[model samples]
Target chain A: MGKILGGDNMKIVMVEPINISMMKIEEYRQQLEAEGHQLIAYSSRAENDQEMIKRVKEADILIIANQPLSAKVINASKDLKMISVAFTGFDHIAMEACRENDILVSNSSGYANQAVAELAFGLVINLMRNIKDSDGAVRVGKTRKNLIGNELFGKNFGIIGFGSIGQKTAKIAAAFGCNILVDDHKQHKLGEELGVEYLPIDKLMQE
Target chain B: MGKILGGDNMKIVMVEPINISMMKIEEYRQQLEAEGHQLIAYSSRAENDQEMIKRVKEADILIIANQPLSAKVINASKDLKMISVAFTGFDHIAMEACRENDILVSNSSGYANQAVAELAFGLVINLMRNIKDSDGAVRVGKTRKNLIGNELFGKNFGIIGFGSIGQKTAKIAAAFGCNILVDDHKQHKLGEELGVEYLPIDKLMQE
Candidate 1:
């Protein structure tokens, strides 16, 4: 009988830590390791860049987050079969090199869409109303007497890149009585659906 | 001409500082004093109870925020007229005493509705995703492996009160893909409009 690469024969390496809320990197490590695969994970940044390249060179699957997997690093992937990104962008990976080397690259796309959207809404509200400043002033034995804040209600909120995150932000802004103006590469029906006005990128920027 | 009981002729007192956004206490003091009324303000809490009473006493009008105006203090109001509260709650003040002395009490009702609503949303996002903990862990040389967090997406979020704040919270929650179940004293059409289901207090608790 011939040996297969399904289990213990394969080596998997995770280059950096990712938000566990979006993707459970540690759990994956434990599960993959338990299944008889050799798992090596750098849960934090590598102190030495050479050590990182050395680690990934022999990997069958490379799961990474913020840490860079440069073209030079990708060139050393003699046994590297796949690169899995735990974040939105694959810019850190050398895509051309991966293609030439017949390496598959996947990403945890839109995993943090809701988180990012909610945060965007939170920040706008916080800035307009000076919530952070108010908390700071109180801590410093001063009231908002010196600070006058504005409300988010009835203001124009401009959103660029009307993707999942932008769409979610528009909805929340609508609830706060904000007039939402969005700009994106594609004209989406979501704007009209959410009572948002779509504008050209240049116009949106000017507005 | 005889001096009438205009601004300059009346004694005014401010029990505490209020948000300049809500109402400028200092500005009011200056304006009232300029208009000819005598103004006394306790920008900070009084060290002595007797001193507090003295400040509240003999004033034609008192502007306060969360400060107690006990019966003893009201009794000292030899010429007390009105109590303007810069916050929603009036229970802090001796309402019965104010009524017995024919003193009118007014509060800045619903002044912080937007601020509270915005903050409520911010906190829920932060907690659900372990944002603060993640930031802290990174600063302390650790990754999210030590902390696994959940997303607000597709979560059932129950709001106990369906007032302004609760409704606002629901609006933001809806934006985050949360199913909103609200329990309130009254049924509002806004619930149906926002696609939020109204549940009984007990049912909401169980859910």
Candidate 2:
């Protein structure tokens, strides 16, 4: 490994914008530079694989956010040692190339767990209350006649996945006095602690 | 009270249908009759003041559900002693008349507390996540460009009334990890137990 003035400074290149402001990226760059690291942040996405390759060729570490990293682009980065994905899912990355090259891959998981859980409740409430239809009716100065909506209380709320998002959703559903029914491949201790009943996927669907 | 074969039986008249079926009302009437009371139930709503006055004239106890019970109707009821309202609010009933006639007035409060609280959350979730707008957009085949929404988690949820509905609302909001700020005319011990911060109505409005 070659030594820089402060330490072994890595050339970290962010191939695509991660929805952060340029000023914020500059602040991050300054902080990293102070710690003996160099950061190259792009304000825009790479239009093509060639552009992606060009941006990541000399990077020791690459940062991306749901931008597809093909094997070709991954192979082009000869010095790439690690990839830091700014999204919960890393499927957009070339796992095969990273495995062959022994490049370490990390993702920003659990970041959107609360947000996703909240959205799940939002969608559930919308359907249960017929909010869209009610909103439309009120806008036209009409009253809800037979549009009396059902309540979530004492209802059986079934969740398919038992991940962070699912667990958070269950917590909220439980708060609303729902009997939670989970259908996950593996039994989670948290689900049990939450007083959730686990059933087969088919049974859960029926429930 | 008149002495019947069963016991001292008072005339119980249900002036209007309380959203219950005729069969259910008949069942109730049979049960009341079995207890030595004569129950006269009207399946339909009284359309006019005259109809309402006529319905209650011979009653000892009246049961109503949001149907207007004017002072004129109350005055016409010579044997009226008590009123059992099937709704949370009794403003539609003549309080002055009941006071003057020495009639006992009771209401079915807390019945719709959970339903109203759940609907409060439904409306909150809908607004926070833009569910209605998103639903509309999806139906029109348009993407949410700048329609990114705020999450209710870790947000301040201020409630105006600290009644049964408001307390239930605070419970659900707390479950969603919100900081509950309540503003009511009186401070409740339950609110304190729930770790809610009480504020003046004006102050809570600002929050």
Candidate 3:
């Protein structure tokens, strides 16, 4: 299997490092090695064109964080088969080059949906109620004065995007009794399902 | 039920009008009224102390958003029993007055936990990797720049509070492969159970 995949001991190279402390990459390395696939993990600051190309040329499976992969780098990589992005958005990858090279690229999605949506609502509430700022004042032993924030109940929530993250955000916001106004380029029946008012981008932005 | 809660034929009066849209409020009002509660919703901007005190004194249950309830107002109120705060945080309420008067003060908790935590992670990732600014540049039709974000595959996440919301936040952060660091005033065994490093508040805050 190792010979077939790497042509006599080829390796899977991960760019930079994963920031998780609980899961050791060594365990993954050993498992892959046992299965006849070697794992080569390196911290590559592939900032410029030359560095990007150099890093891509030396890998089989490349896992990137937020680094942009240019067309020049994608074309230079002869052995690169898979590019697993560690984020939801894939706007950083050179899609045209990947298509030409037949390189499969996948990204982590629906992972941070709940987290992002939760935070947006939290921010809105914090801003409305002055929780953080007020809390900060109290923590510093200051007498609370003129601290007032608004309630989210029956409030207007203008959702910019209606994707998985956006929808999840809308759902949570709805639970808080917020009237959602969603705007998406792709037309769908989510508005009817979620009871959200669908608006054009222009109108939504204006709102 | 209404008469028992108050006296005879008493109505639940809201203070100033909520800043939400009229259509949304009307929908909520219909739901509340369907439950057999007399809703005397007012949108008054009481200018003087006399007007504010009068407005508050008339209500049985004061459903308030961000309006300040002074000690004098609470003391003067003969009918006020419950202060149903529309948002989380009770800093606006004169807590001493409420306690002395036997007024039941309640605030919404666990409403926006998931949303807030998710945003915190997003903010961490975006700040670490510069995703939002990069996306902003791309949206304005700029060539993709070399904006790097950190991977959460293994990182130290120091959680301040270990309440329901904080615990939920930690769980979601844990899913992202973060090493949890908790600092709670309460004597809870979340650290041993969740594999989180329980640190002192001073230490955690410094980090």
Candidate 4:
């Protein structure tokens, strides 16, 4: 196992596909083989634990994306040294199995920071302006009588957490001329630079 | 008409209500009356041409929203010296009457610039991310199987008109990490400042 961990010809298996195309995966496989590592990339997720176990049996490092990796399969992967999660969340992965087998795990954090932040705006605008309702109304030749939407400009935008997603959301809100109020556990220099007002959770809720 | 224009106790009649509340209008009326100008703000729009003509019979200045101001109604306002449009668009008003009657016309332009620009984002995000469909899917216990949406983080945003609304829309787009392309009648220095590429209409459409 130690030899496999440090070996140049380690086997890497991707149990599930990421957002990339199969052609790209094949290109990656060839590139990794050229670097003395054997890459076995799966185009789809394993249907069952038995299949997952079989696929990861010879893998020194396994790549997965949102597919559930149970303790049974993880313990059965005798050569598994590390698990590379291609998603931001690793809750589906068997943490206890990794701990018991001393398997290292890495996740692609911050991969959806901007995407999620932008979605925050989308949801907010949908609520404020009644975008869904208005779109439906206009298609039916209805007037914007009761559907007069509210504006986000000159409004107080409250952010509960000051993580990467929160910071990106604050930037977009500021671009729309919103005053940002943050109630994170700790104050950040970046928040201060963005002129965000820091308040307690209670006070932020009132705002 | 010259006397009406230069009169100290000029009567201003608002034929239709703007977005402001009637209480605010009452406040404005009191303020205007204190300055030797009488402001008669109707809580609702004029029901007919007769009501409109009767309303503006004594008005030296007419303030209207989207209520149609026909040439007949405009011709009947003998004392009308100026038309103060409370809306951005004055197309509903009789522009020909204003010209024939030598009445100066003014509109509240640029009032909805930021509001319109923000709405542009709302609509774009709705279309790109399939927000409406995804929202419906989740409400019905469906997953994002075919509703995996696109992101606006790295996209080309085209602005055909580089007016106030277009400039504001460009600012928000730039904040979202989009490459902006413009095809206004003339190149704007602000577009260059924002690193927006000014292309021909056909070229911009390709982007």
Ranking by TM-score: 2, 4, 1, 3
Q: Between candidates 1 and 2, name the one with more favorable DockQ.
A: 2
| Per-candidate iRMSD | 3.0, 1.1, 7.7, 0.8
lDDT of 2 at B181: 94
For candidate 4, give the docking quality class from DockQ.
medium
Compose the digit string of candidate 2's lDDT tens values, residues A1-207: 221223478999998888787889999999999988999988889899888889999999889999899999989888888898999989989899898877889899998898898888778877887888888899999888667788899999999889888999998898799999998889888888879999888999998
Candidate 3 residue B169 Cα shift, in angstroms, is 18
Which rank order by DockQ, best down to worst?
2, 4, 1, 3
User: Per-residue lDDT tens digits of candidate 3, residues B138-190?
Assistant: 77897545664445546778888788667866766665557888988765665
lDDT (0-100) at residue A202 of candidate 3?
Answer: 80
Task: Report the number of the highest-DockQ candidate.
Answer: 2
Model 3 lDDT per residue over A57-172, tens place: 87787888777788888899888888888889999999888888888888998877755765565456556655556766887997656675555657778988899888777766
Q: Which stretches of candidate 3 lie over 4 Å from their true place?
A: A1-8, A21-23, A140-143, B1-207
- How much lDDT does each candidate structure score? 0.75, 0.86, 0.71, 0.87
lDDT of 1 by residue, A104-180 (tens): 88887787776677767555555665556666688899977746666777788899888777887787788777888
lDDT of 1 by residue, B6-35 (tens): 444788777676544324656776787788
Which of 1 and 4 is ahead in lDDT? 4
What TM-score does the predicted chain A of each candidate obtain versus native chain A? 0.81, 0.83, 0.87, 0.79
Question: Model 1: number of clashes?
Answer: 3
lDDT of 4: 0.87
